[model samples]
Target: MKLTALLLSLSLTASAAIAQSDAASEARDAARDLEEAAVALQQAESSRNRIKALTQVVQSYEDGLAALREGLRRAVIRQQRLEAQLVQQEAEIARLIGVLQTLGNNNSPTLFLHPQGPTGTARAGMMLADVMPALNAEAAELRDALQEVRILRELQLGAADTLQSGLDGAQAARTALSKAISDRTDPPKRFIEDPVQTALLIAATETLEGFASGLTDMSPEPEGLAPLPDISHRRGKLDLPLEAEILLYPDETDASGVTRPGITLATRANTLVSSPVAATIRYRGPLLDLDNVMVLEPQPGLLFVFAGLGAVFGEVGEVIPTGAPLGLMGGNDPKIDAILSQSGEGSGQDRTETLYIEVRDGKTPVDPSEWFNINKDR
Candidate 1:
């Protein structure tokens, strides 16, 4: 009877343990369900918010289009100027060649081979000293003119390419703008609650250091954004965001005596800017003199800053896929023409759009040439 009672007690204990385990599992399941429901509710809210948040992006596209149109106009003017310059240079080069040929034929071989006497030799030497320098100078001029003509021809070809790109860029921007306006569900939300306040801070910060401080302190919360890829390993293999010419390299000092730790590309007007790697949009808007700037972080410490955009896309804290369209370079900025004129990257009067790209590791700037492919063929 005692043995029977003990078996009964053991059975009761086992049943109680099973019951507790089941209760704990149900509790965990309930918690998970609640978490999921909360996420769903947040998404619903975000979707509602995105509807009203598209104005800036649409305005950016319009700005980009205007810039592109301006760029195209400038490019045409530049092409005309280039053609005139090319014609003048070609004519000057031909004249220089003729003059050089005449000078070469002026008894130079005969004089060198047979000097009549000491007096003749001295006279010949004197003639050579005076005439040789002149000849050399003229030859140099011819060479320079020829080089200039070649460069002009290349610019002419490039001008055509730029015009085509400008047209395409404008179309792309318009389409994207329309889509962004219509699409309410997928638009990314601000990492922080107050984006205008963040934009103010970004605009107010004069230096990248200050910007970094503000951003790092913001406690950005990524909601429903995909995780970024490991971007530290891809070196010398990354393609440029645009098929544009690189005008400046890392650590190179510009005319202003400021050393840049990034690369500057001279792209066609209204050229579309894209991300080379999967990244999160850290900041978007003008910061200092750089108009319509956008910042992307591919990893925790690595950040890419692109400035001089005419229009911008993507929201802060949004995780974007590799090669995703960010925005279009502003073609309409008069400053672009000035920059191109200074850089000599334009065909004629119209300057190529300048895209200033700064890559940073933590708060420190790094050379983007080391990470990106700098091939001439793009």
Candidate 2:
């Protein structure tokens, strides 16, 4: 009875939630996806492509966690809105409660009395027949509202367990993938780098543009390196390194008045950053302000610079196959309470970490939005 009363206190919130079809859909989808990843995590160790398998597992957990956050966000909004409605409807609710209390009194003298005689009683009976269906419908809705409260209560309890399981599974998968990257010696080396010149070049340059200008000339010195594939035909259609990704364009200025070149993407915690196309790693690791950068040369003059990675994989001058894991973005997944309490416009504004992507066709910077379809994907 105590539990029931508590749930009733939240009845309006749950009732509002019930009206929105997908209020809990994301939560359910997240649970199902995380559960599936748990099953796959067991087999990932023995799989032929452990890197890919484990990568998928981490991705699943991240995706599930993202969905779970959204579910909780919607729930918070629903409760707030419903609570406001309750304030507005307080008088009506009080009247209904009074009616209910009167109904509960079994010994009321006027319960079966009518003001008028035979014909009036007959008319009243007809009126009562008409009112019964609507009253029954209201009772049914109240019952459903109560049931929804129970479901929401159950979901809140389950979410704590879901969050813990997801965190463990995601961390385990990342550890396995990191090991796989470390143990592998199979990636075809494009050429041996004479880092002496590159290091000298880095020491001379203050900005990425200067280093890149020098790299354009120095990187071509390697002889007999196989030519990379032409992505000219695939100019507008390139796969993103992060899934369910959001992007910001160069034109959109932040609070401070400054413009940025290329496009920026927000990635999930330790999300697998992949090569969009077959390319050679011109340089990997940190340079300038960008932490743990990976620069790729798809063609002689075409360069793609990915920066702010937590970890970079593959060596300088190594051939990276398309969709190969480049590295991971730094950070741990959000906590269970954090996920529930997160609020803002939506997921776009909630991203805390950033991935800087700059593409240069020659000396001129290419807008990465050309390669990544933000409208279609985001």
Candidate 3:
């Protein structure tokens, strides 16, 4: 009876061990699924951002077109008025010519010699001189009017041509924007998982296994496991001197597949924030009269700024870490606090008007959403 009891006890221990192992395996699988879901969410956010940027571009172009159309309308009215004045001046000149012809017939030398006395002839000569000056003045005024009309007509034609060109440009911009919006709104055909995330999961799985073993053995688990940052480093990690969030996403596209990044955080006066990745600083200065604007490189990539947390931080060029306090939230502009990214296809210069952010591996830009925790639900 004692031997049978020992065997049963051993079997029960074996089954318990199997159950624990199975649970660990299930947990690891769940972790993987979670990671994949995160990636998908990032991709969706990227698509949304692209569409937004294109919408802005389209709206801007449309505004310009409207302004041009208004100007064109005004030009047409002015041109017509000038044309009418020119016709009226020509008619007046014709009437003056007829008067001059009648006067010439009456005052001709032959008419003066045949019937007119000396006093009448002398009076006719004086009248002729007076009329000659008036005729010349009228002729000069008509010529001036015609010249003015010609100049105005040329200007009108040029303006019309310019309006047509502007319309063409606006239409092209709208078409491009429409195509971009469509692409972004469309569901992603391919889903990409972050390799770094996969590696992290694998490491976590191994660590969890060790922790479970320690618990089973009644031993202490290893201390000091790295904690995840509150803000997920889903966007490619940047080792920048300044800390801030991406405010806008790029949606506009140029010939090159690059996007422009913009910043909303108010940096210290003249703070030199470097690029998150290795690229040139395309622009560094005030944007729209607001001080502390800096754009960074890698064709189309991240923008960084060292915000002046009044009384705490000094001016620009001061390096800060990824989460270091650059400045407090409130700024003069109420809407400047939001973070965004740009992603369509253009350089930062091409997209300087809007904010943009990008995730890249070395030189190639990847969707930042994959690497950064962009709160998609919000």
Candidate 4:
């Protein structure tokens, strides 16, 4: 009355399909980049265009690190599921082992000599023939599960080294960027701010709105400087000034119950902040509690404002091209362990620093979300 074979056969009949996952494939590339991170960092530091080279290096390290963390997260979850499955199948596995052992023992005469003699023996042999495939299948599954767990364990163990390398490379790149910024010449200026006029504006303006409204008078564009191309045609398709995620949309009420007219972005620590388009720097400095603000006039009557920078680059009235470095975000870069821990929670954002962005068209605050395509980045 051994119904174990019947039960196991039933289980086999309900076998699920193999699932396809991106974790392994995407991470495989990240692993290769991690191995090369150090070399890349060294090369970047020595490059003539240190700022651009170092920026790419830092971003690449961040990408590789993110991929690695994602791989580990998925691998851990997969391993857990496999182990749980194996545990739950313990009784079935024991029965399978018993059946296997009985078949393996050539000296067990009772196996062939069923109680009803020749007729029973023939029937038992036929039943064994039918169940052999299912037993073999179950054993194969068990082997595969064990093998996968071992591979995942090895991946996790090796990850610590790769992650450390990425962290080191990222830090080195940041330092290089900082040094490069200090050495680089100031960008071309479309206008030269009168010291007295700038000082008076700063003293009189109570808010970012007031300052932005008076931007033309603070630093009027001179006649000789070439004007930047209008980006009106590219509305809703402009890149963000940095790799960031929108934390608060325009007009969203925050915990303080204050409604803001701009969007707040969450970005990684020490990451590069750039000008999204060719624009004139109306102003670049600390204002009120909004530290290190940079107001860019991309087109006549249109302005883009950025706030909360650790260090602002370029002088007021400078004309910067699209993608020019503007500033660096403030906050300590997250440790690898912290990144991995956060990855496991299914949100791979290490954005500890916040940057506020405001778009102004003809002196009125507009939603930045309408201009920047942040969804694709996320």
TM values, all candidates: 0.50, 0.84, 0.26, 0.85
Task: Order the numbered candidates by lDDT, best leading.
Answer: 4, 2, 1, 3
Tell me which of candidates 1 and 4 scores higher on lDDT: 4
Better of 2 and 4 by lDDT: 4
Where is model 2 more than 4 Å wrong at Cα?
Answer: 1-20, 79-93, 100-122, 221-225, 244-247, 251-258, 343-345, 348-350, 376-378
Give the best candidate by lDDT.
4
Candidate 2 lDDT trough over 10 residues, lowest sum: 1-10
lDDT of 3 by residue, 229-343 (tens): 3333324354533333334443444346533332222122212222343332223333332333333323222333322222122122222223322222223211111101111
Worst 10 residues of 1 by lDDT: 16-25
lDDT of 4 at 331: 82
Q: Pick the winner on TM-score between candidates 2 and 4.
A: 4
Whole-model Cα lDDT of every candidate shown, in order: 0.58, 0.73, 0.35, 0.76
Could you say which candidate leads in TM-score?
4
Cα deviation of 311, candidate 1, in Å = 0.7
lDDT by residue for model 2 over 1-378, one digit each (tens)? Answer: 232343344455435534643556677888888889889999998999888887778778778777776776665565455445556545554655665477567687566456777677677667656655655554565566456555665676677888788888878888888899899885677788887888899899898888777888785455466677678888878877776354567655645664567667776667778888889999998898878888998877888888889998888888878888899888766776666556423665446567878888777787786776556443
